[model samples]
Target: MLLKEVRDTLGTEVFSKEVERAIEKKVRLHFGGQEVYVKQSRPDPDERALAIRAEYNMTNRRELMERYGLGRSAFYKIIKGG
Candidate 1:
């Protein structure tokens, strides 16, 4: 998938410059069966959610929900501190 697609799919939650670079590096290493070489640790869910909220800048809510695999109620719960 294109970088834009990946970014959209990740919905700014877990999407960071470092994460993007890691993904690109992994993809490039895939042909050599060395994809695991670039493996990096992932942030926990709460941290990811916080990052998403911080990074969010008027992106459509519907699109964000869809991309992040969140239900309407779940998304609202996160935003509303419930």
Candidate 2:
């Protein structure tokens, strides 16, 4: 999937759960060849820096712009580690 699609999907609460499911499925399929379902919970960052990184990871710059109503320059500033 494209980053844009992933970002849009992540906007929903179900996205987290779906990600968990995908991870569990892959682990089971490749490692043990077992069928198992896992519940995916939202990541809770312990530090502000970690949280900001996580937020960035969750969406691309374009998606972030649409979500936060920001411009490219601001997004670039943020992701630039400045």
Report the number of the highest-lDDT candidate.
Answer: 1
What does the lDDT come to for candidate 2? 0.60
Write candidate 2's Cα lDDT for 18-72 as tens digits: 6766766776678685565768764442343344446786456576677656577
User: Tell me, what's the RMSD of every candidate?
Assistant: 11.6, 14.6
lDDT of 1 by residue, 1-82 (tens): 6776888888777787778888888878775554445567767879757755765566677877876777888877767766
Model 2: residues >4 Å from true position, as ranges?
Answer: 1-52
Question: In angstroms, how far off is 77's CA in candidate 1?
Answer: 0.5
lDDT, residue 54, model 2: 62
TM-score per candidate, chains pooled: 0.40, 0.31
Candidate 2, pairs of clashing residues: none
Highest TM-score model number:
1
Runs with alpha carbons beyond 4 Å of true place in candidate 1? 1-43, 57-59
